[model samples]
Target: MMEVPRDLFIPPDALEVFLDTFQGPLDLLLYLIRKHNLEVLDIPMAELTRQYMAYVEIMRANQLELAAEYLLMTALLIEIKSRMLLPRPIIRTNEDDLDPRAELMRRLLEYEQMKLAAQRLNDIPQVERDFTLVQVLIEQTVAKRLPEVNVDDLRNAWITLVVRAQVNRHHRVTRAELSVRSHMSRIMRDLRGREFIEFNELFGPSAGVAEVVVTFLALLELVKESLVEISQSQPIGIIYVKSTDFLTSV
Candidate 1:
């Protein structure tokens, strides 16, 4: 310690020392490792712990507050140092293969990679930092914009359309499905006991046009198959449907 001279008034910030700042403990650890050219994978635990504790002492001497993270890292460094020096128990397990500094090395490597990537990004040319933006103002000769539509007018138009749709709405009749096979079987059964059946009597007026059409198709199919004969009693007389056997001489 040097003897202080009388009337030596030093300002609080006059003797301020600037230490290398780091983003976190990992950053500081990485700095130490790189500064000394030490291998991250094969780290010398004793030397690394000594230098780290020295930094913590320096921080204390400078009256800088040690963050919880820094303290935790300090404890970890000391623990790793001790784990290396002491003899590990002879346990036949995977723990034997695990290096105490493995976790630290992984974290440091990841942080260094990210830091390098960030440095590369920072080196890229930035818009505002590298150059100023140039702005120009021009007078508009003609500004054309589409007319705005009123919501009330659109609503009134929609209401008119709805009213017209309601007034012009027509009924949608979903006609029932009729089976031709069932109609054919029914016609055969009707003609079984009777010699002939009038075409008008075979079709029910209450049945829909679709059913009537299907019945007519079935009668036509029967005639085509020679299972039934459709013939007029006379010219312009009532049409009759009878079995082909009835028409046959046999």
Candidate 2:
């Protein structure tokens, strides 16, 4: 079994449904009239008073706090209902022949107009009510400040970075096959009959890094085998490459 706290103080009318819409009691009356399709000009006082009393009784049963104005309106409705019961003169007179609901109807019409006007005014969004007003403040100075970064800009930047990382992802390393033996044969053909060939002539201008490394290794192997000679005429002078066949002939 669950036990409630000793400090839990619930009010008698804590669970209350608020019916205070755009109009208060008048609005309730208007709603009843409209729902029943009763003409505002020729209101039936008996039915109106009965419905009003039923609502008042519900509020009373629920121990709802009532306003003096609500009680006054209730009394006025009863008086109108009673006046309707009173006998009228056989010969009709001005104002006396009018319905007892005339004054209440006049107020209801005026109240309805005001309510409609208020609703129209409420519908047209005003500052700080329906939407948040965005104001961009610009400060004037010799050194102008850069625009502030908003969440949307930051989010877009993050998305761009993710896309670029995916497109240019360097996760895989591919190994290319280059042969030093092939580069060696290429060098032998280039240095075939040359006594002194400029060092740069043996290498292509558009050689890739892998090809350049292979060519350098091939040149080193030729020099180790005493098949090619590399020489510089003077200090910091242009280097030259030559075959040992020329030196052997000399």
The prediction achieving the highest TM-score against the true structure is: 1
What are the models' TM-scores? 0.48, 0.47
| Candidate 1 error regions (>4 Å) | 1-20, 137-250
Residue 145 of model 1 has an lDDT of 23
Clashes of each: 0, 0
Q: List the residue pairs that clash in candidate 2.
A: none
Residue-level lDDT tens digits of model 2 in 152-200? 5434433444454455545555676879888878888888877777666
Query: Across residues 105-163, which tens digit of lDDT does each residue of candidate 1 receive?
Result: 99999999999999999999999999888989986554322233344543443344445
Residue-level lDDT for 29 in candidate 1:
85
lDDT of each: 0.72, 0.70
